[model samples]
Target: MKSLTFLLVFVPLLSVCRSQSETGVDEELGDEEHVELFTTATTKLAAATSDFGYNLYRALASQDASSNVLLAPLSVSTVLTQLSMGASETAERQLYRALRYHTLQDPQLHNTLRDLLTSTGTTGKGLSTAARVYLSRRLRVKPEFLRLVEQQFGTAPKQLMGGAKDLKDINDWVSQGTGGKVQRFLTKPFPRNTGVNTVSAAHFKGKWENGFSQSNSLESFQIDGGTTVRVPMMHQDNYPVKMGVDSDLSCTIAQIQMQDSVSIFVFLPNDVSANLTTLEESLTAEFVQDLSMTLLPAEVSLMLPVLSFSSTNELQPLLADLGLSDWLTSPGLEKITAQPVKLGTVNHKVVMEMVAEGNRYASSTSPPSHLALRVDKPFLFLVRDESSGALLLVGRMVNPKNLRI
Candidate 1:
């Protein structure tokens, strides 16, 4: 049997705030009503995909609780769902179940995804996503499947000749997709007996709505073993932000806006010695949606670390652990080609950097007020698209100095 490979890359952007008001109009109506129906479908699809991303992140974090973790769950779920279109009935069922899409009653999954891609890829938002499929040179793809993938996912299958040039082509394609932010995504050679491969990338470079001052100071960061390290921390006073405390999770949540309809929600545990396991496990699409609505607006002295890091992770083992072992072992993707193919490996890479670069400020050396919220310890953050309610990235920052995964 031949092996299929999946590659995903995500660069940092931000996240969204969701509204639950539903329109109760009938679907069978005029053009305006059709637009409303499409909007509703895409909204529901975004929520479903976000839930899948949260589940995948929890599974990945469970593997190594101490290490820094970063991933673009939306990109991963998008590529996998795109691949599922070519899967056989049994294989499709397993894939949908793993992705948490089996419970959705909507039949236009592909159409909804197309709408989502269009909505989130708006210009000037500093956010973009793309997907492509590559096939072994020997196998011939079905024309109908090619048309469907091209029309929905915006790319057709290409031939992989299994050489170094093929690797360069893949990397170049990824670089172009992410506007050169993510270059050389695949550093290693493709495995033997590779059959089909899918590549997806998302990139976003965002600025804060209320910019932080360029003048930053080194602050003490508390890590494990009763030790502390000084790191450059961006500071701003009297910043308008949504702040709240989740008693159930025992953490302080802060939502900061960016240029576009994007927000970054920071979850800082009340105790520096607290473990983020409980907070991480408690994240779901519905949970985050409700939590965003309840946060009260407040102005506080804010300090955030200058974070820039990237990680490359092999997700095959994680997916297998998440109850998709059979699908990976025998992914009947017959629609792509007549040849037998199984999922061999899944590779995911993420690059994120949040900096202070919106407005200039005069230098000031003053003590932080009592209402200051300094992110000086381990914390979790979610970058989302507020317009579509899509999760752009989910990350855990433990040791900023150590960027390796």
Candidate 2:
């Protein structure tokens, strides 16, 4: 089965993260063409966000209500920061928006989100707690909403080739895209949804524009769970990295060139393996602003799932935790456009499914393959585009149950 997915790399841009009393802060002083490219990428990314928002809506619509499944959103920048301690909100959003563009590029995958949602029972929250109210009716319109997503994505879908290795490509792109907040999503068995088709891309890669020493990999390392993993940790010396609003937040990034529009980015929170939700919620544009204003370097130690993997999730409540107020059950899907009639409620809905396997592969009894690490907890993550900070696909693995794919 051909991998039906998208891919790209991410780069941070000069955008005002927070207003400063300083004079030159608001102005973006970068190569006009490069900035333009990032701008176009952002446009594609915003569209991708719309697509993922809708796709997630479908995923929520299909979930079994009894599971009490939920999802959470983290600013793309925060996770990248935690991973390697480097990146920006605009850059992270570009990563997310890219995922959206990737989805828009493929009609089969885009439409598939609807099919899987259409088959499930509706029971749960919407993108927002309020959105969940629309489940009954919205669930009925998944096919329609999905159609809307395809139409919204526009003629670009025609440009995508069905035979492309979508998941891997997308993952590679995202790795390069975010400088690597997301290293790899699924590489082994391509993640089986068991019930429907699902595709996910996760990646993080970089060589320290200055190249970290491989000798550092020999150091004894600290794993969040209290056990020490003698990791082959790579170290970058005296790297020019950024600091977040608080001294607690910091980041470092590695640029990956080639194959796909992607990069390898890492964020290092004050505490490695800190509670991600708290970390995400704690993120503020102002803090990011502070981060962009300063740069310094300290010895860095990194430990992550060195491989890719996948799972399943009921992401509604999880979304509620993040701040997506009304896309799901909020009377209607969240309004995409506002003509200023002061729209009350846009008819909205949500549904979810794990996109994995093909007609040929689904029927086979293949052994479950393995990657380097298992996603067992919540961590800020994304698979995004290089040109735009838009998230092609967004997720938080608060729990591995969501990794069933």
Candidate 3:
């Protein structure tokens, strides 16, 4: 897609468990004194998060192969990492393993996360991430936990009295974070005994270095073997694009240029007869990096269907399947406070819009040729931040006619 916009909303289901007794105290900030930036550990964490994201993608895609699936991999991973800061020994272990950061120590893992977030902002992309923990006024939250939240995640824990107005406040925060792309993330009223609530959101709209024209025309898109739909496909000819084929997955990969040190890579299968399962299963951070190296630049004619869709996914079941089970049931978060608590719900929602932009190149550099790459069927695409090598968004367009935007 030419212009891609993504919004990710992550809200942990926070309900209290008053029956259990827990006793613990805050550990001193001993890790901070010894914390140092570990580049190798950071690189490993990036690769691990990508692997975890792909695994989660396959699980989500298996639910409905014909339906579209869009996700912000970095956003979800960062949220889980933040939650780990207050987790006890066993719970933190499961979280680290699930996030693919089991090999990293506490200090190294957090420092790398801080650096990664910083690098993305400096790259000039329209990317933003915000996280907050909302606690009930009745509970006495530990000062150390609040301090770590501010020092590491850059946000303080906010106290909520619990009502419709408090829900509106949280939604307002989400709306402001996503630039109004997500107006109301929390759709239901808060439970009467709701003790803790955590929200994480990310928004991204990348700039194109060589832009596309605003003009668009209706084109035929193959939804499946016996289905065809007409969508407003955007066109740009004589643009230099890197194209290649992945024989293992029976798909062609095309790297499209964008401004602000990033690019959108498209995975179009050879034909509609092929499904995205094979390609989705084969995805990994290393595989994508290697595939990027194999692309050969060529003057190409492109036809990409305009895709804009919003989706919401509940992640509690998926998190359990990924081995982070404690947070859902018997969460041992003694560091946050002495109160016995468990995560209530972990819901993720997104609102995305992809639109045409300026026509920077007035004329084509090469003559119109017979060769072209038209994405007319089910295909997958990803927006990657080149500066820090982070995958910003992953999406699959199965039926272009059913755009939710």
Candidate 4:
């Protein structure tokens, strides 16, 4: 029952959240103590996902060694200086939450993912079969998630929607569950789709021990493709920090650990935005060798924004990309049943979202994750693993239920 309750909590964390043509809601990121606790939540959730995804996300979480080819904006010496002041806590909290949302456990999302291997017959051959088999292991982690999806087949059926909610029920769940952080990822109103749809969502709220000084005002920034935009970047004079480099090639990464274990890493491109590629490419397990160990001290400055995202994508591409091709087809999937189970192949779909409270971007290509994607225009976001650095889920959400598994 406790396990089921945990799965229930992720539903409201919509990965891609759509701006509802309005913004002024009373949102709070909680106090520092509460914020620290989220780090614990994020770490546990990330671990759970790693187990369910079977290290698929673990690969992405790894950050590679820093290379000369990718000169960083900040030096190891400077980063270490900041770390000594104790900033890693904040970064850890952020990383933990991001990983949690990236972990994918929505009912609608599960349906789409389940289909990749839900073969009607035992033609289990190739990657499809493998994926389904691997995913079946999640039955225990997502007992309720499965039942909820099964329920979508009917109402309070003698069965649960794979023991999870149906696509139809997602809207109501998101509206109130996430403090309204997630609303309409579902495109359709109340109509239920005959096809099974898996669902996933995420919500994040955090406050800075110190708010941005409105006086910091506007700043000019360079982005990828050599474009520049005027952005209202936040300014934090001497934020807490942590840093270290185990070896030369193994670049030092600084962090701000939130209460539990979640953390944040700011990748400052030497050329502002030119190194965005490095930031992305270096976000893998093999590359993460340096980060797994080593610690140092440093002084810091921070720019962050308030961000929210919710999205939907076919699970095929993501799974295949993650070395789980064997599970994308029939016979590759698993049947989660007990009694006169009428259930067969299981497909999976996912949605994830998060929010940050801070500021800026190095460039257009590497848009500053300002923690502030104000509701000026309907925007998009993703909850990706801070470890393997893989995108657990992505979606452009206007409707919280806009799923395509």
Candidate 5:
């Protein structure tokens, strides 16, 4: 179980049309003062990294049950908790029970995952995540496990000066930690007693506090109740999202709103040949933070679908069939190098971009009234951090002509 190669690239820029008279009431009291600045240990590490990102997206969607899935489960759970700071106690108890975090305790689980990766790398928050640890320049690490993985993931550990400039310096540090949207993340090379290697990258490009209404009239989409496809749809009328339904996962949840606080929920699945396996086994993290606090705000009439795609996955036999077989068979990192190492080849990559721009303050001829919410077909999306609810990316989108361009 040492295969691990997960990659995802999605492009879906713009589309979120805000209006309820431009969200006033001091923006709902600034979202209740941004949920009182989160911190019951960063809300239990964002509900244990979103319940380990919905159990790693239901073990990678039960192995291709119709393809299309994405990941960044908080950058693969922060590179397995920074390689469990040089794991040992049976691979740090199988990486804290496969990252549900074994009921988080020790040092409040690395200071609440370094304050949830410094509030999801703040600065304009289009979302960003990075993790690294590549040794093997003739091993000999353990300087207190590189000072506890550079004091809880601020980065540190770069030795590998082997072949081809260590694959172009690990693909130029994953294209500058994904700001370049994950270019050439080691297309090939590095697999010959590769002592140790762990890299994680996540990049998101959704910035729509309000915008949408681009239509070249393609529509059609329903890839299920007897296949169809036309794509290129993004529109809005009243738009001011946050809707709900759920009848126990029958689906149809919305939530949209992106810009600094970041939130995109979308579930869909009413039944276009429904089979999202009970909405992907009814996701967790306290049921998606109580369905994002009981979604309500309305004024809909939206239609989405301009999504772009890219996915390349291996995921170490789906994380050793999800029980994490001793973290890929016998991983006692030996404090990251005592002439003995185990876990190797775990490269993860993700990139996203979503599209439709045009809300310089609404009035793009706002006419159509209430309830419409059309998202054509197969769906499931999540990309939160609504001030610390954290699950940074998780997707499904079944098909949009599988756009990899």
Candidate 6:
């Protein structure tokens, strides 16, 4: 199938830190030793986050199957894990259960997070992730918490004055963190007496391993059951990529390789009669792992619609819907501060693009026999960090014409 280039971004609200009293500093590992540590910790983290991501997506899809949806489960979990570090007993229980952290106990969770973020930001990679907590200047955050955050997350809490200028500064900080892909992340004014605001951001931009044909053309796109719109479709003939089918879900799975160490997997239903719910519910870290192991490479002609969109969701309601309800109350954050502290307007924003950029198309060769795959209808896709097998960005495209840029 044709190679697709996509840029995916996710912004999630959450905060966290390490603990000096609860846990001692972990010994540093050498390159070889760290690789093993990362592999173990990341695998456990991936399982928890993947379960949470699929669960969250299921909740979103239930409300509006025809609307475009995007999110970064890793982003949310990473920030929440940090929040859990300082959470009171009640709040910590809820957060840990929601993240499925109970399944695996990685003593070096904080150190592993540090390594993961550092590894993903190496030069030439198209992915980056960041998390930080903004505390009110009036509050006295624990010194132990501050030290751990600085040592583990690599960023210290910034004092928020709770003014328009401070909001502008936070937005600007997010924009710069994501390479200007996301701006105005916080549009609403900071609430009075806001004690803590957690923020997480992730961005990825990658080119196709085999560049798509630059000759883009207009084609019919099925936004939903009753709507049809024309959209720019990029095409490539005899593209080599891994392909598979999950008959139980009645969908075709294709893994498109990126120039960097990443892959985008698209799940397009076999036809209009196919069930999207079945496919979505079946997604898990283990399923993806199996697919990657079994996917066979083959030459195929592909047609995919271009998409650029952004979506924002209020995370409080969604988190509640997912059984993380206690965070909306006074006792939810007793451990965070002596003063009563409750969550306020936890928001998530996602920006994505599938434009062809800096592609170097190889000289055309004699055409070979190939299968044809055309994505003309609503579908679910995810951009994954190949090395860690973590889902960087997962989204559904219902209407290619509904451009949110």
Instruction: Give the candidate number with the greatest TM-score.
Output: 1
- Considering TM-score, which of the candidate structures 2 and 5 is the better prediction for this target? 2
Candidate 1 backbone collisions, by pair: 14-383, 14-384, 15-263, 15-383, 15-384, 15-385, 16-384, 16-385, 16-386
Task: Compute the lDDT of residue 36 as modeled in candidate 6.
Answer: 26
Tell me the whole-model lDDT of each prediction, alpha carbons only: 0.74, 0.29, 0.70, 0.30, 0.73, 0.70
Report model 3's TM-score to 2 decimal places. 0.84
lDDT string, candidate 3, 31-110, tens digits? 22332222566566666777777777777878888888887777778766766777899878877788877765546678
Q: Where in model 2 is the C-alpha error above 4 Å? A: 1-149, 154-219, 224-226, 235-245, 248-265, 271-278, 284-311, 322-387, 391-405
The C-alpha TM-scores of every prediction are: 0.85, 0.36, 0.84, 0.44, 0.34, 0.84
Error of 2 at 91 (Å): 30
Off by over 4 Å in 3: 1-41, 136-138, 191-196
Angstrom error at residue 179, model 1: 0.4
lDDT of 1: 0.74
Give the per-residue lDDT digits (tens) of candidate 1, residues 1-405.
Answer: 011111111123222222222232233443332122114666778887888888889988988878888888777887888788889999899998888788777888888787877777676456666566667777777888878877787777676877798889988888787778776788865676777666666666667787886435788888866788888788888777787666557788988887778888999987878889998987877667655666767667899988767777777678776679888888899988888876655667676767786545444455443466889998999887787788888888887764432
The best candidate in terms of lDDT: 1
**Worst lDDT 10-window in candidate 4:** 1-10
lDDT of 2 by residue, 189-293 (tens): 222221111222222221122332333233344446665444233332233222222223332221221113322223333454664444344332222222222
Please provide, for model 4 over 73-184, each residue's C-alpha lDDT reduced to its tens digit, 9 standing for 90 to 100: 1111111111111213443233223223234343343232233213210121100011111122223222443444344321111222422243345555544534454556
Mind giving the per-residue lDDT tens digits that candidate 5 earns over 56-148? 789888877787788878887887788887877877877788787787665667877887788788767676767787877777777888887
